[model samples]
Target: MKPIVRVVRTGTANLASVVASLRRVDAEPVLCADPALLRAADRVVLPGVGALGAAMGTLQGDLGDALRARVEAGRPTLAICLGLQLLLEGSDESPGVPALGLVPGRARRFDGDALRVPQLGWNRVEPDAGCRLLEPGYAYFAHSFYLPDAPEGWAVARTTHGVTYTSALERGPVLACQFHPELSGAWGLGLLARWLEA
Candidate 1:
Protein backbone atom coordinates (compact mmCIF):
# COMPACT_ATOMS: atom_id res chain seq x y z
CA MET A 1 0.00 0.00 0.00
CA LYS A 2 1.09 3.59 -0.57
CA PRO A 3 2.36 5.52 2.41
CA ILE A 4 -0.07 8.09 3.78
CA VAL A 5 1.41 11.59 3.72
CA ARG A 6 -0.48 14.26 5.58
CA VAL A 7 0.11 17.80 4.33
CA VAL A 8 -0.25 19.99 7.40
CA ARG A 9 -2.25 23.10 6.52
CA THR A 10 -0.16 26.00 7.69
CA GLY A 11 -2.06 28.52 5.54
CA THR A 12 0.95 29.09 3.29
CA ALA A 13 0.67 30.00 -0.35
CA ASN A 14 1.30 27.35 -3.00
CA LEU A 15 -0.09 24.63 -0.78
CA ALA A 16 -2.11 23.15 -3.64
CA SER A 17 1.07 22.81 -5.69
CA VAL A 18 2.54 20.64 -2.96
CA VAL A 19 -0.50 18.39 -2.94
CA ALA A 20 -0.26 17.96 -6.69
CA SER A 21 3.43 17.15 -6.44
CA LEU A 22 2.76 14.43 -3.89
CA ARG A 23 0.07 12.91 -6.08
CA ARG A 24 2.55 12.78 -8.96
CA VAL A 25 4.88 10.76 -6.77
CA ASP A 26 2.09 8.23 -6.16
CA ALA A 27 1.96 8.85 -2.45
CA GLU A 28 -1.37 9.53 -0.75
CA PRO A 29 -1.76 13.20 0.20
CA VAL A 30 -4.17 14.35 2.89
CA LEU A 31 -4.78 18.12 3.11
CA CYS A 32 -5.31 18.73 6.78
CA ALA A 33 -4.98 21.42 9.46
CA ASP A 34 -6.68 19.42 12.15
CA PRO A 35 -4.48 18.61 15.13
CA ALA A 36 -5.82 15.06 15.37
CA LEU A 37 -4.78 14.31 11.83
CA LEU A 38 -1.35 15.76 12.46
CA ARG A 39 -0.94 13.63 15.56
CA ALA A 40 -1.89 10.45 13.75
CA ALA A 41 0.19 11.02 10.64
CA ASP A 42 2.63 8.34 9.56
CA ARG A 43 4.38 10.87 7.34
CA VAL A 44 3.77 14.60 7.50
CA VAL A 45 4.49 17.40 5.04
CA LEU A 46 4.67 20.89 6.49
CA PRO A 47 4.52 23.27 3.52
CA GLY A 48 4.37 27.05 3.62
CA VAL A 49 4.88 30.02 1.29
CA GLY A 50 4.06 33.25 3.15
CA ALA A 51 4.93 35.50 6.03
CA LEU A 52 6.51 33.85 9.11
CA GLY A 53 4.37 35.77 11.55
CA ALA A 54 1.12 34.73 9.93
CA ALA A 55 2.20 31.13 9.56
CA MET A 56 3.06 30.81 13.23
CA GLY A 57 -0.17 32.53 14.15
CA THR A 58 -2.19 29.81 12.44
CA LEU A 59 -0.28 26.95 14.14
CA GLN A 60 -1.03 28.08 17.67
CA GLY A 61 -1.91 26.17 20.88
CA ASP A 62 -2.42 22.37 20.72
CA LEU A 63 -1.80 22.19 17.02
CA GLY A 64 1.63 23.63 17.58
CA ASP A 65 2.23 21.37 20.58
CA ALA A 66 1.22 18.26 18.64
CA LEU A 67 3.55 19.08 15.78
CA ARG A 68 6.39 19.52 18.22
CA ALA A 69 5.65 16.17 19.80
CA ARG A 70 5.50 14.46 16.44
CA VAL A 71 8.83 15.90 15.33
CA GLU A 72 10.44 15.15 18.65
CA ALA A 73 9.42 11.52 18.28
CA GLY A 74 11.27 11.48 14.95
CA ARG A 75 8.31 10.73 12.71
CA PRO A 76 8.86 11.14 8.98
CA THR A 77 8.28 14.86 8.42
CA LEU A 78 9.05 17.24 5.56
CA ALA A 79 9.14 21.03 5.74
CA ILE A 80 9.23 23.25 2.66
CA CYS A 81 10.19 26.90 2.20
CA LEU A 82 8.45 28.95 4.88
CA GLY A 83 7.60 25.66 6.59
CA LEU A 84 11.34 25.02 6.74
CA GLN A 85 11.90 28.53 8.08
CA LEU A 86 9.31 28.00 10.80
CA LEU A 87 11.33 25.03 12.13
CA LEU A 88 14.07 27.40 13.21
CA GLU A 89 14.18 29.45 16.41
CA GLY A 90 12.96 32.60 14.68
CA SER A 91 13.18 34.70 11.57
CA ASP A 92 14.61 38.18 10.87
CA GLU A 93 11.75 38.82 8.45
CA SER A 94 9.36 39.40 11.33
CA PRO A 95 11.45 40.38 14.30
CA GLY A 96 10.36 38.98 17.69
CA VAL A 97 8.12 36.37 16.09
CA PRO A 98 8.78 33.01 17.74
CA ALA A 99 9.14 29.85 15.68
CA LEU A 100 8.86 26.08 16.26
CA GLY A 101 12.64 25.82 16.94
CA LEU A 102 12.92 22.18 15.81
CA VAL A 103 16.25 22.95 14.17
CA PRO A 104 18.57 25.21 16.12
CA GLY A 105 18.97 28.32 13.93
CA ARG A 106 17.65 31.68 12.85
CA ALA A 107 16.36 32.84 9.48
CA ARG A 108 18.20 35.91 8.16
CA ARG A 109 17.60 38.28 5.28
CA PHE A 110 19.87 38.55 2.26
CA ASP A 111 22.55 41.18 2.59
CA GLY A 112 24.37 43.34 0.01
CA ASP A 113 22.87 44.83 -3.15
CA ALA A 114 24.63 42.39 -5.45
CA LEU A 115 21.50 40.22 -5.90
CA ARG A 116 17.81 40.95 -6.13
CA VAL A 117 15.57 40.24 -3.16
CA PRO A 118 13.13 37.28 -2.97
CA GLN A 119 15.37 35.32 -5.38
CA LEU A 120 12.47 34.69 -7.75
CA GLY A 121 14.01 32.04 -10.03
CA TRP A 122 15.76 28.73 -10.37
CA ASN A 123 19.07 28.26 -8.57
CA ARG A 124 21.56 25.40 -8.19
CA VAL A 125 22.04 23.56 -4.89
CA GLU A 126 25.05 21.50 -3.85
CA PRO A 127 23.78 18.49 -1.95
CA ASP A 128 25.87 16.95 0.77
CA ALA A 129 27.53 13.60 0.05
CA GLY A 130 24.86 12.01 2.23
CA CYS A 131 21.93 13.48 0.28
CA ARG A 132 20.99 10.62 -2.08
CA LEU A 133 17.61 11.78 -3.38
CA LEU A 134 19.05 14.44 -5.70
CA GLU A 135 22.29 15.29 -7.40
CA PRO A 136 23.51 18.90 -7.52
CA GLY A 137 21.07 20.84 -9.72
CA TYR A 138 18.84 23.87 -9.94
CA ALA A 139 15.65 24.07 -7.83
CA TYR A 140 12.88 26.66 -7.62
CA PHE A 141 13.38 29.39 -5.00
CA ALA A 142 11.27 32.40 -3.94
CA HIS A 143 12.18 33.81 -0.59
CA SER A 144 13.91 36.82 0.95
CA PHE A 145 15.04 35.24 4.22
CA TYR A 146 17.23 32.15 4.74
CA LEU A 147 18.70 30.16 7.58
CA PRO A 148 22.43 30.89 7.53
CA ASP A 149 23.30 29.21 10.81
CA ALA A 150 21.64 25.91 11.66
CA PRO A 151 23.94 24.11 14.07
CA GLU A 152 26.50 21.72 12.65
CA GLY A 153 25.42 18.52 10.83
CA TRP A 154 21.82 19.65 10.25
CA ALA A 155 22.32 20.99 6.74
CA VAL A 156 22.23 18.29 4.09
CA ALA A 157 22.47 20.69 1.16
CA ARG A 158 23.78 24.17 0.49
CA THR A 159 23.01 26.74 -2.21
CA THR A 160 24.52 30.11 -2.98
CA HIS A 161 22.46 33.22 -3.58
CA GLY A 162 24.00 36.30 -1.94
CA VAL A 163 25.54 33.87 0.52
CA THR A 164 25.90 30.14 1.08
CA TYR A 165 22.77 29.16 2.98
CA THR A 166 21.08 25.93 3.92
CA SER A 167 19.10 24.57 1.00
CA ALA A 168 18.00 21.42 2.79
CA LEU A 169 18.26 19.87 6.24
CA GLU A 170 18.09 16.24 7.31
CA ARG A 171 18.13 14.97 10.87
CA GLY A 172 16.53 11.61 11.43
CA PRO A 173 13.00 11.47 9.98
CA VAL A 174 12.78 15.25 9.59
CA LEU A 175 13.66 16.80 6.21
CA ALA A 176 13.36 20.42 5.14
CA CYS A 177 14.00 22.39 1.96
CA GLN A 178 14.35 26.09 1.39
CA PHE A 179 13.35 25.67 -2.25
CA HIS A 180 9.98 24.51 -3.58
CA PRO A 181 10.35 20.92 -4.72
CA GLU A 182 6.74 20.99 -5.92
CA LEU A 183 7.43 23.68 -8.53
CA SER A 184 10.82 22.29 -9.56
CA GLY A 185 9.66 20.00 -12.38
CA ALA A 186 10.93 16.41 -12.71
CA TRP A 187 13.84 16.50 -10.31
CA GLY A 188 11.53 17.94 -7.66
CA LEU A 189 9.05 15.13 -8.06
CA GLY A 190 11.89 12.63 -7.81
CA LEU A 191 13.01 14.20 -4.56
CA LEU A 192 9.49 14.03 -3.14
CA ALA A 193 9.28 10.37 -4.18
CA ARG A 194 12.46 9.57 -2.27
CA TRP A 195 11.04 11.19 0.86
CA LEU A 196 7.83 9.20 0.56
CA GLU A 197 9.81 6.00 0.28
CA ALA A 198 11.70 6.89 3.44
Candidate 2:
Protein backbone atom coordinates (compact mmCIF):
# COMPACT_ATOMS: atom_id res chain seq x y z
CA MET A 1 0.00 0.00 0.00
CA LYS A 2 1.09 3.53 -0.70
CA PRO A 3 2.24 5.49 2.34
CA ILE A 4 -0.42 7.76 3.69
CA VAL A 5 1.24 11.14 4.25
CA ARG A 6 -0.81 13.59 6.27
CA VAL A 7 -0.05 17.18 5.31
CA VAL A 8 -0.93 19.85 7.84
CA ARG A 9 -3.26 22.52 6.49
CA THR A 10 -1.33 25.58 7.67
CA GLY A 11 -3.66 27.92 5.74
CA THR A 12 -0.63 29.57 4.11
CA ALA A 13 1.28 26.77 2.41
CA ASN A 14 1.11 25.87 -1.26
CA LEU A 15 -0.74 22.59 -0.71
CA ALA A 16 -1.39 21.88 -4.39
CA SER A 17 2.28 21.59 -5.31
CA VAL A 18 3.08 19.59 -2.18
CA VAL A 19 0.21 17.19 -2.85
CA ALA A 20 1.20 16.71 -6.49
CA SER A 21 4.81 16.05 -5.54
CA LEU A 22 3.80 13.39 -3.02
CA ARG A 23 1.65 11.72 -5.68
CA ARG A 24 4.66 11.69 -8.02
CA VAL A 25 6.47 9.61 -5.43
CA ASP A 26 3.48 7.20 -5.19
CA ALA A 27 2.48 8.30 -1.68
CA GLU A 28 -1.13 9.11 -0.85
CA PRO A 29 -1.26 12.74 0.25
CA VAL A 30 -4.03 13.85 2.58
CA LEU A 31 -4.54 17.55 3.25
CA CYS A 32 -5.64 17.73 6.85
CA ALA A 33 -6.38 20.36 9.47
CA ASP A 34 -7.46 17.89 12.08
CA PRO A 35 -5.05 17.58 14.98
CA ALA A 36 -6.00 13.97 15.72
CA LEU A 37 -5.11 12.89 12.17
CA LEU A 38 -1.79 14.70 12.38
CA ARG A 39 -0.89 12.93 15.58
CA ALA A 40 -1.80 9.51 14.27
CA ALA A 41 -0.57 9.59 10.67
CA ASP A 42 2.37 7.37 9.77
CA ARG A 43 4.02 10.24 7.95
CA VAL A 44 3.39 13.95 8.02
CA VAL A 45 4.46 16.91 5.89
CA LEU A 46 4.30 20.44 7.22
CA PRO A 47 4.59 22.93 4.34
CA GLY A 48 4.19 26.68 4.74
CA VAL A 49 4.48 29.65 2.35
CA GLY A 50 3.44 32.84 4.16
CA ALA A 51 4.09 34.89 7.26
CA LEU A 52 5.13 33.10 10.44
CA GLY A 53 2.50 34.85 12.55
CA ALA A 54 -0.35 33.83 10.31
CA ALA A 55 0.78 30.22 10.08
CA MET A 56 1.23 30.11 13.85
CA GLY A 57 -2.24 31.49 14.30
CA THR A 58 -3.71 28.60 12.34
CA LEU A 59 -1.60 26.15 14.34
CA GLN A 60 -2.20 27.84 17.71
CA GLY A 61 -4.06 25.21 19.68
CA ASP A 62 -4.50 21.47 19.15
CA LEU A 63 -2.73 21.43 15.80
CA GLY A 64 0.36 22.89 17.45
CA ASP A 65 0.24 20.37 20.26
CA ALA A 66 -0.13 17.47 17.81
CA LEU A 67 2.91 18.57 15.83
CA ARG A 68 4.98 19.02 18.95
CA ALA A 69 4.08 15.55 20.12
CA ARG A 70 4.88 14.01 16.76
CA VAL A 71 8.32 15.59 16.52
CA GLU A 72 9.21 15.01 20.14
CA ALA A 73 8.46 11.34 19.69
CA GLY A 74 10.79 11.22 16.66
CA ARG A 75 7.99 10.29 14.30
CA PRO A 76 8.39 10.73 10.55
CA THR A 77 7.81 14.40 9.85
CA LEU A 78 8.95 16.71 7.06
CA ALA A 79 8.86 20.46 7.60
CA ILE A 80 9.49 22.63 4.53
CA CYS A 81 10.18 26.35 4.08
CA LEU A 82 8.22 28.26 6.69
CA GLY A 83 7.43 24.91 8.18
CA LEU A 84 11.10 24.64 8.97
CA GLN A 85 11.08 28.07 10.53
CA LEU A 86 8.08 27.16 12.64
CA LEU A 87 10.08 24.39 14.26
CA LEU A 88 12.36 26.95 15.79
CA GLU A 89 11.81 28.98 18.98
CA GLY A 90 10.65 32.11 17.18
CA SER A 91 11.37 34.38 14.22
CA ASP A 92 12.41 37.97 13.62
CA GLU A 93 9.58 38.20 11.10
CA SER A 94 7.10 38.11 13.97
CA PRO A 95 8.61 39.20 17.24
CA GLY A 96 7.23 37.98 20.59
CA VAL A 97 5.53 35.00 18.94
CA PRO A 98 6.69 31.61 20.13
CA ALA A 99 7.26 28.77 17.70
CA LEU A 100 7.17 25.02 18.33
CA GLY A 101 10.69 25.10 19.84
CA LEU A 102 11.41 21.60 18.60
CA VAL A 103 14.77 22.91 17.46
CA PRO A 104 16.85 25.50 19.23
CA GLY A 105 17.41 29.07 17.97
CA ARG A 106 15.24 31.42 15.96
CA ALA A 107 14.83 32.57 12.35
CA ARG A 108 16.59 35.75 11.33
CA ARG A 109 16.32 37.75 8.11
CA PHE A 110 18.97 37.23 5.47
CA ASP A 111 21.33 40.15 5.07
CA GLY A 112 19.89 42.18 2.21
CA ASP A 113 23.03 44.35 2.13
CA ALA A 114 25.17 41.35 1.20
CA LEU A 115 22.89 39.83 -1.43
CA ARG A 116 19.28 39.45 -2.52
CA VAL A 117 16.75 39.36 0.30
CA PRO A 118 14.63 36.30 -0.49
CA GLN A 119 17.20 34.01 -2.03
CA LEU A 120 15.23 32.73 -4.98
CA GLY A 121 16.23 30.10 -7.60
CA TRP A 122 18.27 26.94 -7.08
CA ASN A 123 21.15 26.54 -4.64
CA ARG A 124 23.42 23.65 -3.76
CA VAL A 125 22.71 21.78 -0.51
CA GLU A 126 25.82 20.17 0.92
CA PRO A 127 24.69 17.38 3.19
CA ASP A 128 26.82 16.36 6.13
CA ALA A 129 27.85 12.79 6.81
CA GLY A 130 25.16 10.53 8.38
CA CYS A 131 22.20 12.28 6.81
CA ARG A 132 19.64 9.69 5.67
CA LEU A 133 17.39 11.77 3.40
CA LEU A 134 19.36 14.74 2.11
CA GLU A 135 21.82 14.61 -0.78
CA PRO A 136 24.16 17.11 -2.36
CA GLY A 137 22.06 18.84 -5.02
CA TYR A 138 20.70 22.16 -6.16
CA ALA A 139 17.38 22.60 -4.37
CA TYR A 140 15.00 25.46 -5.00
CA PHE A 141 15.01 28.04 -2.16
CA ALA A 142 12.61 30.93 -1.59
CA HIS A 143 12.96 32.45 1.84
CA SER A 144 14.01 35.67 3.60
CA PHE A 145 14.52 34.33 7.10
CA TYR A 146 16.89 31.43 7.91
CA LEU A 147 18.38 29.51 10.79
CA PRO A 148 21.95 30.79 10.96
CA ASP A 149 23.34 27.70 12.63
CA ALA A 150 22.35 24.09 12.82
CA PRO A 151 20.88 22.94 16.10
CA GLU A 152 23.28 20.83 18.11
CA GLY A 153 23.06 17.01 17.65
CA TRP A 154 21.04 17.10 14.42
CA ALA A 155 22.42 16.02 11.04
CA VAL A 156 22.93 19.27 9.16
CA ALA A 157 23.11 20.45 5.56
CA ARG A 158 24.23 23.91 4.68
CA THR A 159 23.56 26.31 1.77
CA THR A 160 24.97 29.70 0.93
CA HIS A 161 23.18 32.72 -0.48
CA GLY A 162 24.28 35.81 1.46
CA VAL A 163 25.62 33.91 4.42
CA THR A 164 25.89 30.16 4.97
CA TYR A 165 22.97 28.73 6.94
CA THR A 166 21.35 25.43 7.78
CA SER A 167 19.45 24.29 4.69
CA ALA A 168 18.31 20.92 5.98
CA LEU A 169 18.31 19.06 9.26
CA GLU A 170 17.61 15.44 10.15
CA ARG A 171 17.33 13.72 13.50
CA GLY A 172 15.84 10.28 13.86
CA PRO A 173 12.69 10.33 11.69
CA VAL A 174 12.20 14.10 11.66
CA LEU A 175 13.52 16.05 8.67
CA ALA A 176 13.21 19.74 7.93
CA CYS A 177 14.26 21.74 4.88
CA GLN A 178 14.63 25.45 4.38
CA PHE A 179 14.18 24.91 0.65
CA HIS A 180 11.11 23.77 -1.26
CA PRO A 181 11.60 20.14 -2.28
CA GLU A 182 8.16 19.83 -3.86
CA LEU A 183 9.09 22.38 -6.53
CA SER A 184 12.73 21.22 -6.83
CA GLY A 185 12.43 18.83 -9.78
CA ALA A 186 14.21 15.42 -9.67
CA TRP A 187 16.47 16.15 -6.73
CA GLY A 188 13.49 17.16 -4.66
CA LEU A 189 11.49 14.10 -5.65
CA GLY A 190 14.40 11.91 -4.71
CA LEU A 191 14.50 13.56 -1.30
CA LEU A 192 10.79 12.91 -0.84
CA ALA A 193 11.20 9.29 -1.94
CA ARG A 194 13.98 8.79 0.57
CA TRP A 195 11.87 10.30 3.30
CA LEU A 196 8.98 7.99 2.41
CA GLU A 197 11.29 4.99 2.52
CA ALA A 198 12.47 5.99 5.96
Enumerate clash totals for all models, in the order shown: 0, 0
**TM-score (all chains, Cα) for each model:** 0.94, 0.98
Q: Highest TM-score, which number?
A: 2
Least lDDT summed over 10 consecutive residues: which range in candidate 2? 110-119
Instruction: Score residue 9 of candidate 1 by CA lDDT.
Output: 79
Number of the top-ranking candidate, with lDDT as the measure = 2
Task: Supply candidate 2's per-residue lDDT for 13.
Answer: 80
Badly placed stretches (over 4 Å) of model 2 are: 112-114
Which pairs of residues collide in candidate 1? none
Worst 10 residues of 1 by lDDT: 147-156
Clashes of 2: 0
